[model samples]
Target chain A: MKVLEAETYQAGEVHRFEAAGQEFVYLAPAGGIFGISAAAAAVLETMGAAGRRMDELRAEMRAAGFSAGDVEEALEELIEARVLERPRTLPPPRQKMPERFPLQSLVMNLTNQCNLSCKYCYEYGEDKVATPDGKPKFMDWETAKASVDFFLQDSAGRERLHITFFGGETLMNFPLLKKVVDYAEAAAGAQGRAVDFSLTTNATLLTPAIIGFLADKRIGVTVSIDGPPDMNKLRVFANGRPSYDVIAPKIRELLARHRTRPVGARVTLTAEVTDCIRIFRHLTEDLGFQEVGFAPVTSSQKNLVTIGSGKMDSILEQFCALADEYLAAALENRQHAFSNVTDTIAELHEGVNKSHPCGAALGLVGVGPSGDIAPCHRFVDSDTHKLGNVFTGIDRSKQADFLERGHIDAKYDCHTCWARPLCAGGCHHEAYVRYGDTGHPNLHYCDWIRTWTDKCLRVYGAIAAQNPGFLEHFERRKAS
Target chain B: MKHLRAVNRKAVRVAGEIDAAAADVHALQEGAPPQPKPVPHYPVGCTIVFSPGWEVDSSGGTAGLCQPAERDLYDCYATCFWPAQVPDHLNNYPDWTKKCASATKDWREIDLVFP
Candidate 1:
């Protein structure tokens, strides 16, 4: 028989909160949440900041009316869960940056020309990153084919590949887009690999034939629309006429025709477009979109359409209100198309700890119209962030510098932030636009992101306690 | 369940005692309270009773769970060993961990389904 010996234990970092009338702890070391018992809480409280030896802890538990066996069991459970630990063993090493990460997806920029002259347009407006001179406005077939073959070759052992059509307006080069899809499908099929296709379109050029083809191919679609006519005043044509009337009917046709995949709306939240709920309702209830996601416009601080810090409060409040609705819907096992909340909740469910702001330039990259490779879609035509050309292949030296600089370890401010795992110091493009350096953290978004992450954590906790089964459903939804 | 027994022995011991007591009371005119038998392992479809379980282990106990379940989640996804509960990343969601190389660390990079 083994004899239990007295040992000293130090408590691990934990974020304790109440959700759905249950006390829970977000165990930082383990990156998991567990509904702790009253006894467990008592044990932690008694242990306090200085921690306690086994003898002291056992005596305290006995005084608190817990049996010896129960006390030992709880201690074992807590220790095993990593809520308590031996005084000092070296902390686990940080995740090392992989020497060679595989490529899985690419954002193919079909064109650099759009009919709409949206005021907040990142690609063509006042904040434009100066589209490099002499590049083709519309992607030619040769460049498109090389891009496809580049993706196939780069993502060598990967069984599944993904291509996302992007642009100043993706559908501007619809003819080329069709040819590229056909060529990619046949090319991928020959290799016994599967390629998933999706596209972000401005919806002005969605003809009946295009819509039918999109539906048949089951291509995922994200339509760029702000809201109802009044809200979309910024999204106007070169003649300064609102594009709502033109795109509305076309979007409806596309939505009506595209049945194979869920259609989503991507709203650019600027200074004027702050009513998230109103916009979400208009797009989901009225426009019949399956999901609606919002991104605060990222550009230079002086840009007129930039979402100001003052207005961020309102945006966050509206987000919280919508999140409450999402929680309500989730409790009943129904999905609410408030995608911002949906995405954050999903991240929380998986206990996400990000190393970079996003998948950009990691598993995914962007191919510009002229076959120039960039970090992501937003950087497609930007001369500064050009990674390489599809023909010559990715410049690993430049790629390494970008990744190393963007890594969470390099972000000093993020080292102490609890939400770093989710934000990873915020978007790389946003950081570059705001601070002129991709390595810089988006300090402007720190408070907003922390508050938002906390709220999402609460929502995750509530759903977990009330309807854990729904999490399983959500997991399946994401996986499927 | 076997893995649970190996991972958390004490919990299984306590649970086994409880199960045995219940079995003794619920037995149908049994002699010597019928000794507890080990569950036989076999190749089965989505074997929830064999390996990693969510809430309850094969012993019908709470003690054998992976203390913080996230620790073993990626292993399960990678091997497709336990598909009764979680998605098998090997087949169903191959791109699930494309950005998340280290499940214990980079779980945030796991992709979510979007339109």
Candidate 2:
């Protein structure tokens, strides 16, 4: 039926608030906030939070001490605004989702082998999920090549490819990393394509030659460092020796040498290290890392080390202060070097209506040491949730199961959620650990994300209004 | 479920009776909303920019594809045409004038304070 003035429209999950002394309604599905008049607010109040026929609504407002002229005027404004819509029963798909996985980034677990025995290391931690074989691991040349070949075969034609090296310690299998880089780059070049290389490492084994090689290759590197020595108590070497003193210099060295792409510092926030501002400052200002991102430990193990719900508010409070600093700098047209805030706000600014948290089960796959393919790097060692292996091919049935389960369409709770458009159901890894099911949404962090998103939205609003020119950098970033 | 907090609100040039009523409404609600919110404290000269990976659009959701040109205190819609990915997303906000657009709908308005 064509939308007519007579039709009743139910209010969807809308956020109604008064700001700057004006009544504003945030239509979630439409992603708009309109500053309605006092008369309009009174008209909406007559609607009694439920939608009704315009004629009936007019009568209701009339009964509520409103004149017919006022009611008609409000109706005209509301209908013209499309604010009173036909009551969204179905969420509009934000983007055309890919049916077949267009493989781009393949995380290769070169070796489960590690030189460190950090308390917070997931693979070595209390809640470590064992590989199927239940054996200590390392990827062989054949397995690694098959993983590359699988991405190539399955990649539905892409010009650029990404291969991220992962490990108990990636440098433990430096030879494999070198081989894959050499092989993949050559293959890409042969196909008139290109490849980007990146790796996550402990930074304990960075030799000058290795750093030079990485610098020459222009591969992005993410060093896993928590914070200052006192804060990084959980990140210890195998012999219970402090690894910060060793890695801090390596991080500085990496940042100083790497120029093509910014080297990022990754900090895992646990109960052992909840200091957000200090950690961020130490990494960016002290270590001179170009960017830094933080993540609370997602381990399922019940322990004092796990970041419980109580700590979330405090951590988020500290995070908000830093985000403020980031915003303050942006308003002044200065970069604050806060990668997480920068990244989160970037998505909000772009209107990224995400249908899933990350393209974990979509554009990328994680290859285990033994050549098995899982949904992502976090699930590489899980007995269940394993998609398939490169040796044979992806188990389409299993992949479908994950895709169906992980899609926002399948999450019942997300249907009416205001933040669902962006969050899509937090991280699959977090969901699995927190809820014991990869398909479930990460409920533990829901409030945190919602509040954080609101905070970022406000920051975006302030920046967009204050310094409109600074956003040109976002476009430049894409072109680069 | 949403109520304005009197303490949090800074009475930005609204009429007298309504402002007092808004404060009364807020007082009825329990506790206060989160603090250090995105209240625009920066003055007129502070120029804002887009965060990385984001582009200016006329609207949000499926209709959020129109590229916007940066104006002195706001971003204005440059082209009437929608992005190829969202070819149909044009003039989503019926309440606004034709060329007006915002980064997102989280703001109260899209003027000098939030565009």
Candidate 3:
């Protein structure tokens, strides 16, 4: 018996070895293994042509009564024997994107044009005045129909569609927006699908009429507001005017109009740490919103760029501390509350298996206007991570190739680390944009996970201590 | 009736053993005496022995040297006297007794239903 050991290879590096009278193939980063007997190698050359997912091959082998376990073991043996050529570094190839649960959410970019022109906006550039056509563009009826068609096909015309209106501000194309909603409602009624609509806006365009329409449709709203007016200093228009004051009143109006439906507020934190708690408290207590979350701006834009690594750490610490305080207050007051950081932590703790908690962005595909599909929304703009085009669907043969070549396949400290099962190497987009490679794990993420896990453990321990019979009580309640 | 016959056969086998082991073997050879076998062990709170063919006389039965009344079968192979307690002639072969004890421990207890 020959014992073959597991080996790690860098991206694009190729190594060859033979064992057990068979040739094997291995790819690093993506880490797929395949085996071919000496006699089968000749046939493999012909069969390995282009466009085959490993799943298809595995399925055929499974039908022949070769258990998946045995097939994988043989593949691993081939990998250890060095019969396969390991490629060192390859560009992200087109791999099959997992299409589970069908498509529930669709981001309809109403127009690439924005009113506030926030300094950290992804589309914000020095030549911000010009749209894609060198003029302000809006999604017309036909474009909206086409987008809806794409979504319906993926969803298999399923019920309960979640459509998100995105843009410089989706409200900029109010006429087209109304038309699309009307068309969607009619189409959904005919097809027996229930349509749920939501829009992410700056709130400056949220006039009384707009609020009435949104409230009438029972549409959920998430306004972009970064802390208080002063904290939102960086979020200004092209003329360098702060937009918080102008948007705050409109937000208040919408909140009053749509008090029943949940209103979510998003903040983009910069390096500023002054009065962070007060700002968060004002948003939570004074604004009376149901949920609040934040995403750091990517480092792509010129002005008001994302904070440096050191400052980013400080910012995250401050935000998390503020969130903890807010959550504690909400719990004490018995009020409805939501915090993304805490929610993510709770989810991690509640997961059944220690490994593979939530599906972060593994199978999720984000579609851009050009019909190109990226792994997630974060990498929509980065050409290197584009998996495939939705227009042609996914090219199965190229799926594995894309995954191997993608920046996400790069080496990260998280891969071999124990915390990997939880963090899953952090956000690939953040790693790529911030560290220049997707393979490298973010230390900030590690720090966050460690802090969150510690906090969760402490809370659970305290609860168990206070309520000694909590476990028995909970188990009994569940049993009945 | 068939079970009574089986029990009679077992009694005859015991009678032969008593003839070989007993000091008064010649008396039993002239006129056989009814030999009482030790009761078998059975689980608690259950009727183990049937009437007429077999009956339990004591709880532990024979000072723990013999099987308890609840036992289904009287495992004679497991019964061994202490070397100091038994006659020297019987203690001559220690290995044989040990093998008999192990064999008795391996025996299965089955319930025999009477017609």
What overall lDDT goes with each candidate model?
Answer: 0.77, 0.69, 0.50
User: Candidate 1 on B2-107: residue-level lDDT in tens?
Assistant: 1011111223343454445444322211222345456522112223212363333454333345543354566576676554444566656777668867654564
lDDT tens per residue, model 3, A27-100: 22222223334332422332242323345545555676666666555443333333332433544463344544
Ranking by TM-score: 1, 2, 3
Better of 1 and 3 by lDDT: 1
Q: Each model's TM-score?
A: 0.77, 0.73, 0.55
Regions more than 4 Å wrong, model 3: A1-101, A125-136, A157-159, A188-191, A273-275, A300-304, A308-320, A323-333, A336-338, A352-374, A378-412, A416-422, A436-440, A460-480, B1-115
Model 3 is docked with a DockQ of 0.01
What shift in Å separates residue B42 of candidate 3 from its native position after superposition?
Answer: 32
- lDDT digits (tens) for residues A264-292 of candidate 2: 88889987588888988888888888888
Report the lDDT of model 1 for residue A165: 97
Cα interface RMSD of each candidate = 10.3, 11.0, 33.7
Per-prediction tally of clashes: 3, 8, 33
Query: How much is A147 displaced in model 1, in angstroms?
Result: 0.6
How does chain A of candidate 1 score by TM-score against the true chain A?
Answer: 0.92
